[model samples]
Target: MPKQPDPARRSERSRQAILDATRELVSEVGYAKVSIEAIAARAGVGKQTIYRWWRSKGAVVFDSFLALSDAGEGDLALPDTGDIEADLKAVMRATVAEFADPAFSAPIRALNMEIIGDPGLAAQYLEKLAGPLDEAKKARLRSAQQAGQIAPDADLDLALELLYAPLYQRWLLRSGPLTPEYADALVDLTLKALRPSARP
Candidate 1:
């Protein structure tokens, strides 16, 4: 007979199955329709098994997001080429493509709208997603500052806004497409506009 699986291995398999079920359900039905019972049924696991791991469906959704984010096919990190303009363009192009992907668009759009409508949930979402993304952008701006490519007096906070407001306006508001040329143009214009005068 085949040897019995270890307890840890079994636990790991169960967790992965639950997460996978959550992703599939979220993709099929919007977050509003995804439920713990549905996930348990889809995963082929007992409802109690899911309850043993997650207290609510939101936790399961968050776990699935973390899994998808870690896959690294998305715009998770900016390239550090010591040239801020090129790095920004590269990251922005990647962001546009990732945001445009069908697999990510619907769930993300729904999640963003839900977060905006619910204040309590918005706070949680900001802490989980927006806050980290902003901090990472600030770090990139600071790196450019140290390199003297951007102004020494550059406000990382404001610069962060300048860097993303156009893109966010496009992504969330659908005012325009975040094309490669648009991204490159934004970076070029930003460098020319924000750079310290040569006299200074």
Candidate 2:
């Protein structure tokens, strides 16, 4: 008798295939045009398989984007070197690089445009994409506070916004270049604000 395939491996393969299909289709046809049926066909898996794993097209696409990030270089984890400024600068620089990358930039821009036109979709996008990144930054800020790098009473949510708002404005408005120097400047300014005041 022929050897049977491992159920776990088969499931993993199916999951990866679905994600890969989603990415390719989204890149080719844009997120608004991609559908579960098309993704299932491209993945060569039954439609029920995708529905079993993801509740909607947006959820599938979100997972696909995450998988792409994982395959490329893992998630956007902030570096913790104990030097808050240096760590923030490193992450911001990486963010600039991702924004400069065509593969990442184009799809993200498409999603941003979609969100601007649809309030409901905007909320979903924020929950799926921005929410995790914001939480991670807040956690890092809290760690810095504990280390005395940041003010004990700093509002972490506002502090996080200060770190990235300029970059976001530039990207959204297409008003200026998002260079590494710009990212460094944003980090420098944010660190100056967040750092505990020196004793007189």
lDDT of each: 0.75, 0.83
Model 1 regions lying over 4 Å from their true place: 1-17, 27-29, 44-59, 69-77
Clashing pairs in 1: none
What lDDT is reached at residue 145 by model 1?
83
Q: Model 2 Cα displacement at 34 (Å)?
A: 2.1
lDDT of 2 by residue, 171-193 (tens): 87879888899999999998898
Please estimate how well model 2 matches the true structure, expressed as its whole-model Cα lDDT. 0.83
Per candidate, the number of residue pairs that clash is 0, 0
